[model samples]
Target: MNIRQMIKENNRLQDAMTPDNLSYYQDMVVYIRSSAVQERQCEELLLEMARRLLDAQDKGKDAKDVFGNDLESYCKEQIERLPKRKGLSALQYHLMIPWIALTWFFFVQAIVGFVTMWAGGPVERMTQVRISTLILIAGGAYVLIHVLMKWMKSDAFKPEAAQRKISARNIGVYVAITVLILVAGVWLGRHLPVLVIAPWVSLFIFLIGLTGTKLLFSTK
Candidate 1:
């Protein structure tokens, strides 16, 4: 019998074994022992009965391997039933490959923004050239490394690893949201007189957007 059927039979056997129903219990036990159920099934049913007795006596411990092995076996059966596909079957890895590529591109753009903002001051002509050159080199290296890695590696999206990396990206999104708020606050301060720091006003608005996104995307 399949596992599920075996479980059902076990449940029926258990219901018949209650101490308050001694006659019924004895009859059920006799029926089970005399039945044509396989020796293995009989042994499993007895083991389950012993486990329950132990639990009732507050001496039972968990059976780690049994459940886990059953699940693993079940999963293997399901996989065998699926249509065959080429290469690694991890979907998260494939998805993260593109994400990693996109993140690298955006990271380069952010660096460029920093370089421009730092170099554009009126007093530092030499600083502009130095900073801009460094930004360009850094951005170029980032793109080159990403391309090379993608070309060389086969499976880029391992979900377990990608989950951690995506958490870091979420943190970065928070930082970006903070910066935008600061900019808006500065703009507001320049235009309107306020009791609180003018920058904070814009910051509040920025925080709202960030908080909204976090709420919308949060899974749990």
Candidate 2:
């Protein structure tokens, strides 16, 4: 029978069932319908399941016996066995990457600017320097994260070769990086003359950094 007929029959059976039976049937239908399987295949699967339920009920078996106790888990297991559909196309990725990168860049800058202003960096010039420095840092970090993500996806970077255990060496490396960043920030704060740098310079650097990040991240 066609899917439409099967659906009508299933609805008729559901209408005749008890409240708890109806609820269970509805939940199972939802779980299966939400899966990535093709619409025709999903409908056929549901139709078969409904037929089995009706048969079991006629034999005087409980709903739990007809469709197991854990319907959700059963549905998940079945769906997992289905082959995955192809993900977004390259064109879609290209369209989306710039927007995603811009979002991250803006979010990081906003947080940095808020914290700097709250910390009482002089509103006139020092605040601008701090904000500029932060924008550059954030841009650099954004590029780094994308680079690392790419590297992680490479076949050369096998899961087995990855460091599963965190050791003192890793902890020490992190600490060293943190210290260097703090030192660099302090040095810039002290040595960089806030007034000597034009406001346009910061804007230009930010724009350049943003463009560089987009290019670095968007390339395959």
Predicted candidate 1 versus true structure: per-residue lDDT over 1-220, tens digit per residue: 7656765666665554335332322333343333345445554654464355435434333322222323234333433444432333355434334334433434444455446556763323222222233333344445445544442222122234664776576567557755655565556556653222122332443455445434543333
Please tell me which predicted candidate would have the highest lDDT against the true structure.
2
Q: Residue-wise lDDT of candidate 2 within 77-130, one digit each (tens)?
A: 767766544445565545444445554455554455556667876534432435
Clashing pairs in 2: none
Deviation (Å) of 196 in candidate 2? 37
Measured by TM-score, how close is model 2 to the native structure? 0.38
What is the total number of backbone clashes in candidate 2?
0
TM-score to true structure, per model: 0.20, 0.38
Best model number under TM-score:
2
lDDT, candidate 2, at 143: 48
lDDT of each: 0.42, 0.59
The superposed Cα distance between candidate 2 and the true structure at residue 187, in angstroms, equals 33
In candidate 2, which residue ranges exceed 4 Å CA deviation? 82-220
